[model samples]
Target: MVPVTTTQIHSRPSLTIIGGGPGGYEAAMVAAKLGAAVTIVESKGMGGSAVLTDVVPSKTLIATADSMRRASGASGLGVELGDEPARADMRVANRRLLALASEQSNDIRRGLERSGVRIVIGQGRLVGPTTVEAVTESGTEIIESENVLIATGASPRELPTAVPDGERIFNWTQVYSLTEVPEHMIVVGSGVTGAEFASAYNQLGAKVSLVSSRDRVLPGEDPDAAVVLEEAFVEDGVNLVSKTRAESVERTADGVRVQLTGGRILEGSHCLVAVGGIPNTAGLGLEEAGVKLKDSGHIAVDGVSRTSVPGVYAAGDCTGVFALASVAAMQGRVAVAHLLGDAVKPFQPHLVTSNIFTSPEIATVGVTEEQVASGKYQADILKLDLSTNPRAKMQNVTRGFVKIFARKGSGTVIGGVVVAPRASELIYSLALAVSQRLHVDDLANTYTVYPSISGSISEAARRLHVHL
Candidate 1:
């Protein structure tokens, strides 16, 4: 395809979106629908990290891995034992996941094309508030627009010495490249992603070791929710190396060795570095454009996704607002709405909901225990274990619970955590309540389905006033 000449540039309210991830692409579609001539510049595939690396591939792998776990344990529920416990053929699963990832990417590409948005497959750098330079396979092209959306997402952060080679040692994103499952996987970091991979592999018949710098797993999550997840991991036979800091990881001929700060060494067939992701903001002219980045290297944006620089906006992982796909999508929408002077809700970081895709997944919204401790709110908490729920009993699920946090005086539900099977689906009610600041009495008054796990959520809210 011949490159369009600079002379062919049309006059319109042009919107150039950098980084074609969920945030960027979604923003481009919205902008196009709003009659803005849109262009999306991307370094990688259209779906960016979520589709090409993170969300799509991980969830696809999880589906197959979860099925194997269920089949393997079916005998324990009085079902006749299969000839042998079903095993996960990672080679086959990897092929399936890659195909699904490709399909998702294509879907995004087609959707954008059909919406009259131009896609430039290359790196985009800001030349000015309304000018973006894209270096593509064909050649360099400058997109002069009335507005620019910086949606450049984040990349998996690597430890100084534990660089991934896409083989024995790999980051969370590169782990999907493996065609074979590791005999033993040592997951470094106890964060949400780390816990999810550790749990998935352990359930898929891989001996797993989780190294945590903190005293317990998922240290940053709700304390009670973390406790329940730790118990579930232990029950799944995951080797939890808690309070042991990872000094470095090196790959040897036989396996990978993780050296701890206290001089302990843990060996495993593969090492997964899930420490975290760093925003892809550097080398993008953000500094030159006068956009402020936070200490953690994330673009600083206010309530409406407007960055420190005027006429420039950023959203998604670039803004470092919770690092969730849903939040990223929301930020992108708000950024476009604010830019177009349309009716837009102010970005509310506190009300953004997130979920950890682990077994008996952890879903949460609003404030946390640390916030309450820091005097953010005078609140009381109530927790109800799933063991008391009839549906949980029917499903043979015992290791989970729901906890709700509410204002001490007003009884307004401010935050909540659900640690049960399909917790992502069950946490929406809590998310709505937190977003709207619904009172605990409002939840307690509503009726959940009979024999539903979500009953624990309402029951927990009912306990707030009684215990406080």
Candidate 2:
């Protein structure tokens, strides 16, 4: 555990947070800052899956693979790598990735402690509206609070026929324990997690196959962005099996065999299942405490993160309202503000931004093309390919584009998408415009650095402004 500096004590309103993931810890900090005495109960390590297993570990692995892929392409930039080529040591990479995950988790714990939030290593349940029962290795402890927050988070959903053995068969969380890079990896499911891992491993030099139950990868994302990624996946030697689902996964003599819905079998060194996630709400005494839950087992909460029971709120994956970590943090903060008598704004998910960290990352903010086609809003759309950007040419980036959507007559920027190497970073300006209801002319007037991918944003805005 990381050490933190303790401050002088002061009497404050009491608040308790169950689960120390982004949602729990973030809310704890907010409540503490607002002069609330905060206690966080967590069964696993701090930072939850976002740090210990799912987000941090996976992104760290992808970063290593991304660097290797960049080095392999250095020849195009007139860079030489001697006679021998670069190779990644999977054992060392996995070890470093796990270390980084642990370090980040500790950092989060320290930050919370520094904010005067008490951390408890235990499993917490809602015994009453404002009471919590924590069971630790030491013993059962009861805590009383004016407010309670449930953020137990979620776990990877597993299919009965494709249960993970944690060796040849794995879930998104278990893949980090592999001692060697899989010679071939079959990734089932085409959601954000599946697409990202599939693309990362493929670039990491694994023979990768992506099985999608939908017509294309990333069925929930922009169709144009998906098309670019699917093309790139195939060009990079990834066998994409579309409109197919994995029926079952069984270990063979040396590897694993994945049977698809159509009787097709894919043999690989390992199989990773990324179907979805199941909320961790059972046995937590939520129902007994009068907290309503959806049929899917997720806590039912309003925009301000309020549950059916007053003084008891929920956030993060457990609420099933936008699984992104950023959204979770915001939801947590909102819940704390409402509980602590601070001015609070209900969570507006439409203002949130989401990203997929694949080779050519895909990012979007606000309204989507699907929403437009659904006739919910009338908007003009514009797209500018990165190939036309001078910065992209200099960086040898041949794929991706910047797309913007604006109201037809008003020219207000409603939403946008970016597909490029650093689309995650480039989507912020568009996010700001959409959130603030800034018009296309507002973005068009903004000055962008020369020879940068961001220039495409302003350029697209200029074109949209002309039509308006």
- Overall lDDT per candidate, in order of appearance: 0.87, 0.91
Model 2 lDDT tens row, 1-468: 333222222366888889988999899988988888998999988998888988999999999889988988899999999888777788999999999999999999999889988988988898889888888777777888888999988999999999999999999999988877789999999999999999989888899999999999999999999999998998899999999889999999999999999799999999999999999999999999999999999999999999999999999999999888898899999999998889998999779899999989999999999999999989999999998999999998989999999987899999999999989899999999999999999999999999899999999999987541
For model 2, the stretches where C-alpha displacement exceeds 4 angstroms are 1-11
Minimal lDDT window, size 10, model 2 = 1-10
lDDT (tens digit, per residue) of candidate 1 on 1-468: 647444124666678899999899999999889887899999888889899899999988878877877787676677876577677889899889988998999999999999999998988999876789888888788888777889988999899989898899999888877877789999999998899899889878899999998899988888888888888888889999989878899989989999998799999999999998999988999888888889988999998998887878998998888788888888889989988878999888798788988887899999898899999888898878888999887777878888898988889999988888788999999999998889898998899888789888878887775444
The C-alpha stretches of model 1 lying farther than 4 A from their native spots are: 1-4, 7-11, 464-468
TM-score of 1: 0.95
